[model samples]
Target: MELKPYRDNVGALLFNGAGLVLVARRADMPDAEGAAGGWQLPQGGVDPGEDLRAAVLRELAEEIGTDRAEIIAEHPEWLTYDFPPELAGRGFRIAQRYRGQRQRWFALRFTGRDADIRLDADSHPEFDAWRWAGIEELPALAVSFKRPIYEVLAQAFGPLARALASAAKSR
Candidate 1:
């Protein structure tokens, strides 16, 4: 039996031309690093009545300050994770009211330069820093609770990331 509804969320695994994925450190954890909490993908809640695709793009712009990306792939089904026991009763409304998040994951190919990523684009920014990480490095960089989701994403998108990276190398 579930305790509460899962929050509707969308996550973007943004790949740069070199096939490196974009990971950003949330503002709240500006100095955190390693598996306990370090970096995470660009993702956010889906607003009421908004399309998932649009939500992903909006989240990218909101979280990392760029929408210069093209959707290349999507996970076949929604994936979910639960909030850690310690955080479940915290003040965060999502954790308080939801089991975790039911996410639609998108793979996006970045078409802009590194300079285009400006975390300050939003006055109230979610992330304080950003970097392009190897796809395999995602799970290790994420918070522990989100590591399973990140691992699944790395597997689902690994081939595509490698292909894109190789293509970039050939040119």
Candidate 2:
């Protein structure tokens, strides 16, 4: 079989002041295959010719509600993941043309209050629910294919996550 290219995408790990990362429940989870109704960080495709940083911010606003987050750090390397065989060619708009995603991940500090989030901000919402979760909790909450990425993120951002959590507790 011919090898297919991966989709260029951007992912955000939005952390509150307390260090909990933001996760959203996919509103359009595939009904028959793939992980069923699990939480995931905000991510979307990078538009052709779009700058990576700009794409990250745009994806945050598009997937969540507000772009009230500041970049803390970025993963040093681009991360790629493939969809489960069962999910390949499922016609999902984001994955329809590719084997999976090649993502540039960002670590962002959310500057907005919880009230600032609006699942309905877009005409078609991607998430039905949102919550803040501890860094270690990410891997477990994520779908299987995404777990490895989350694990790497948890490690890559561990220091910042701990500091934020400590600061929040001190307040």
Candidate 3:
């Protein structure tokens, strides 16, 4: 049985062969607006029967449109954040159901080329468009509520990114 985190989300941060991390541009978002409009890593909530790691792998495929990615590493702990009272109650009824969210972040190395991506493959698209972004710029793309989580992801994934880079040089 999976010991799921209460109201927690799981997601993966995928980096391509070129050492560039993948991010999706969430166009047409009302609440996120310009702040949420920037590039973002693939993420999703853990389903009822799914484990945290499984959830992330599933999210990566569903959000970005591919199932072939290597799990490089993951954060030792879960990262968390909360939305403000104002925005929390608005936009989509489910948003107000929780005080905050805890996320398990994964680092994945995508072996496939960019042509393999399909953001709208799922019934509901989380992002309309996608692009590769510098890992350093992630925190800035997130909203205030999600910034803390992004910071943690950036910190945890930094070493993995470096390792990925070094490994590429040897090939």
- What are the Cα lDDT values of the candidates? 0.88, 0.87, 0.75
TM-score of each: 0.92, 0.91, 0.84
The segments of candidate 2 whose C-alpha lies over 4 angstroms from its true place after superposition are: 30-36
RMSD per candidate (Å) reads: 2.5, 2.1, 4.1
RMSD of 3: 4.1
* Steric clashes per prediction: 0, 0, 0
Candidate 2, residues 1-171, lDDT tens digits: the string is 027789899999999999999999987774456543779999999989999989999998888889999998899899989877665445565555577889999999999999988889999998889999998898898889899998998888988899999999999
What digit string (tens of lDDT, one per residue) describes model 1 on residues 49-140? 99999999999988888899999999999999988665654455668778889999999999899999999999988777788899999999
Better of 1 and 3 by lDDT: 1
Candidate 1 lDDT trough over 10 residues, lowest sum = 28-37
Error of 1 at 148 (Å): 0.7
- Indicate the residue-level lDDT of 2 in model 2: 26
At residue 19, candidate 2 shows an lDDT of: 92
